[model samples]
Target: MMRAFKSLFWIEFKLSVRAMNLVLFGLFSPAVVAVIIGVIYGAKPAFDGAGYSFMAQSFGALSGIGICATGLMGLPLALADYRHRKILKRFEVTPVSPGMLLFVQVAVNFVYALAAMAMVYGICRMFGGGWEGGSFLYFGLSFLLVTVSIYSLGMLVASVAGNIKTANLLCTVLYFPMLIFSGATLPYEVMPPALQHVADIMPLTQGVKLMKNAALGLPIENAAVPVAVMVILAVICVVVSIRFFRWE
Candidate 1:
């Protein structure tokens, strides 16, 4: 099973790269954003009193962008396409289990998201930015928390969506808005009061805030709320996805 899973993962990963959507948005885009920011800001403090480089301050938000692309967009679309083509049903009759396909799909997207984040971090380093002293571990944990919560939403969408069109619609609705308003592509502080209020309601925004503090070595006050929100979202989404998942 392990060997079969690995093989499937490799194949799916290649297919995803060839398709280019995941590669463009999940892998290249975030890294590009990081490079652009690093070149422009180059170790500058995020703000007058922030004391952290702009790259460090933006790390979490940039990482969240990869997750949004690979999780909310890539994962669901892959699942929907597999279902639409009856590849999942075909898997039931082979040594390769349908569940393996599901695992492979998720695993492939997870790799894309993480690899993109690592590339972004490397680019940050090139521009003279890095995580605070002894802070990378905490930053990683925070990033993982956000990734799991967001991926669960992708699974939920796959379970509910009957076709690629529906998956694309759901992904676009969640993906674009999060990228724009969650401080992934845009600075959160620039948003006005009303928009800030609205952005605060988004899970990615809270996740970004959590990750940003971790990356910056800043005090993370009221962290319980964000943690709880992510945990609850993951639990609910995973449960519903399993119960309603369309294997065929």
Candidate 2:
């Protein structure tokens, strides 16, 4: 079973590499944006009492972007394509299960998302914008929670989508709004009060806030709400996806 999983994972990884859009958006784009932001603001000093530099905040936000791109966009599209092509149906007659294929897809995309985050962090550090946080453990936990929650949402989309085209459309509809309001694409500070309230309700917004605070080494206040939200969201989505998943 382990060997079968390994084979499926490698195959999925290779297929992902061959998909130029996935490579571009899921992997390279965040790194590119980090480099650009670092070059532009690398010299700026940390904001008053903000603990970390502006570049760190930007990188933190960009990390969420990469996570969202892979978890919310790439994963669903790939899984939907598999369903559309009847790949999942074909797996049912073999020793390998469709559940294993889904696992492999999730594992491979999680790696991609982490690699993208690492690449963005490296670029930021190379440009003199390394993280100023003190607690690696806390940051790791926050990152894990955000990634799992977001990926669960993707899984929900894959389980419910009827075809690749619908998956892509749904992902797009979710992606742009999350990107815009979550401060991944736009600065959250500059958003109007009403808009900020709306953004506050978004899961990614809370994720980004948690990540930014963790990255900045700031004491996370009122964190219970976001943490609970993400945990609940992940659990519910995973349960629903598993219960209603379609192999064909």
Candidate 3:
């Protein structure tokens, strides 16, 4: 079982690397958006929020949202399309299990997310964004939470989507609201009361909240709420996604 799983994983990885378009879509688009935002508002303060540096906060928030858009959107659409085309069904006829296929896809996407994040960090650093948080463990944990949450959510969407087009459409529909109100591009406090209420339910908002707290070395309690929300989302998505996932 382990050997079969490893073979299946490598096959998926090689396919993903050869699919240049998926790499571009999954990795490049978010980096572009981050660059545009950094160029436009890189020098400006993030907001008037007390004790928070604007660029640091913005870069942190941007990294969180970029992960969401890339992972949840690009990863699921590709998976759904592969399944819709019976690619997964072909694998099913082999010694490979459906679970292994899902795991491999998730692993590939996590790598893509990490690469996109590196681009975000490097560009932000070039543009004068500073990392005030001294602890690598803190950053790793926060990044892990957000990445797991988004990846699980992507799996959930892929299970439900019948085709690539539908998955693409749905992912976009789900992403924009979070970007707008979740303190990704815009801070939640500046939003109107109604919008703030809506944004509170967004997983990325919670993800951003946790990321900011970690980046700034704040008390764990400062991140507890958002981390809890992300964990819940991840759990729910994983259960439902596995239950409903289709190979063709």
Candidate 4:
């Protein structure tokens, strides 16, 4: 089992690396955005010494983009392609179980997510000052939570999509709106109150808020609602995906 798992993991990892478009948007996009934001706001003071430095906040927000790109776009498309091509069905009779395939994909994509986050963090630290509001541990944990939550949503997407075309369509529908309204592409503070409320209901918005608060080292009292929302969303999506997922 261990050997099979290891082989599956490496195969998935290789396929992920070969996916140039996913690599570009999922990993490099965040890094590029961080560099741009850092250059624009590198001189700004920390927000009254109570909020994140502008660079830090930008990094936190763009991190969500990476997560969304991977979970919302990359994972679904790849998995759907496998199903469409009947690859999962072929694996059913082998020592490598369909569940193992799912595990390998999730694990590989997770590594991509982490690498993307790290790249964004490194870029921001180089151009702006390093994270000024929270301890490394706090920020890391928040990032991990947000990634898992988004990845769960991706699994749900893959579960329902019956073909590659459907997966891509669904991802497109979910991806653009979430990216635009979830405070990933726009600063939340400047949004209109109505739009802010709408954004608040989005899973990625909650994730972004959690990450930004952690980056700023803000008091957790105001962050409790988003934290709860993210946790619940993660749990619900994971359960639903597992229950409904089709290997063939």
Candidate 5:
């Protein structure tokens, strides 16, 4: 089983890489966005009275771009399309289980998101004034929580969507709003009061807030809301995904 899983994972990894458009986007889009924002805003205050610069405040949000792209869209879409085509059904007769296929898809998408995140951090360190966080450890914890939450949510999407078309529609509905308004692609600090109120209710927005607070070395207690929200979201999504998972 271990050997079969390894072989399956390798095949999926190669397939993920072959989709160069998506692979490149996931790997470098965050760095590209970072360059544009860093050039425009530099060390300027993110907003009036905000202690951090725009670049610093945006680092956490920028890191989430690939998460939305892969975890929220790519992962679920790939899994659903496979199911729609009966690829998973073939695995049912083999030693490989449906759970193994799901795991491989999740692993592939997680790799992309992790690579993008690392690139974002490296670019930020080079040109985005670096982070003020006193400890990467706590920031790592925050990143882990956000990643798990988003991917678990993606798993739920795969479990529920009956076909590629449905998955695509669902992803569009969820991804665009999160990508546009969750501060992943925009400056959340400058958003209007009403929009900020709405955006704050989003899990990704809360995750970004959790990340930002950690990056700023702010007291962890200050991020109680986002932390709890992401934790609950991850748990609920994972449970639901497992309960409703479909091989067909």
Candidate 6:
């Protein structure tokens, strides 16, 4: 099973790179948005008295958002295309299991999301950003949890979607509502009570919360709920994705 999974991972990774649209869409969009937001917010601290750098927070938020976006949107689209092409069906005929395929897809996307995160963090640091001490473990785990959760959701999307176009459309429609309300673009504190209630249920919002806590070197207790939510969502997604996944 381990060997099968590794083989599938390489195959999916190659396919991901070959699909230039997915690569560009995943890599560039959030980068552009992060740059714009980071530049604007990083220019001046929201309150000079707070002794906080707004760019650091913005960068952290951007990293979480970027990872979630790629894991959720880009991954599903690629898998949908594979399903549409009968690639999944072809694999079904082989000794490789659906579980292997799904795991590979998730693993490959996690790596991509991590790479994107590294790029974002590097860019921020190059521009004079700094991190609070004692946050490395929290940040690492939060990022890992969020990435895995969203990657599983993308697999769920691939399982349910009929084709690449439908999957792309569904992912797009689902993305903004979640993203906007997820505290990535707008502060959760600024949201109305109803909206905040809605955002609280969203995985992306939980992701943002985790990222922020990590960036601030806050205690892990502050991140416990979000981490739990992400884990639950990931489990649900993986189970449902397997239950409904179609070979052809």
Best by TM-score: 2
Compared with the true structure, what per-residue lDDT tens digits does model 4 show for residues 147-168? 8788888888887788888889
Give per-residue lDDT, candidate 2, residue 48: 67
Query: Which pairs of residues have clashing backbones in candidate 6?
Result: none
RMSD of 4: 2.0
lDDT of each residue in 111-168, candidate 3, tens digit only: 7778877887777776666466635687778878888888887888888888888888
lDDT score, candidate 1, position 73: 89
Q: lDDT per residue, candidate 1, 24-125, as tens digits?
A: 989999999998998899989888987678887777788888998898989888889988998777776788644455567779999999999899888888
| Model 2's TM-score against the true structure | 0.94
lDDT of 6 by residue, 179-223 (tens): 788887777767999989988888888887878767867655656
How high is the lDDT of residue 193 in model 1?
Answer: 89
* Candidate 5 per-residue lDDT over residues 99-218, each given as its tens digit: 677677778887888888888777776665558754688778877888888888888999888888889898889888998999898878679999999998888887877777778877
lDDT of 2: 0.84
Backbone collision count in every prediction?
A: 0, 0, 1, 0, 0, 0
Query: What TM-score does model 5 achieve against the real structure?
Result: 0.90
lDDT of 3 at 158: 84
What range of 10 consecutive residues in model 6 has the weakest lDDT sum? 125-134
Which candidate has the highest lDDT of all? 1
Model 1 TM: 0.92
Note the residue pairs that clash in candidate 2.
none
Number of clashes in model 2? Answer: 0
Which structure is stronger by TM-score: 3 or 6? 6
The ten-residue window of minimal lDDT in model 2 covers 43-52
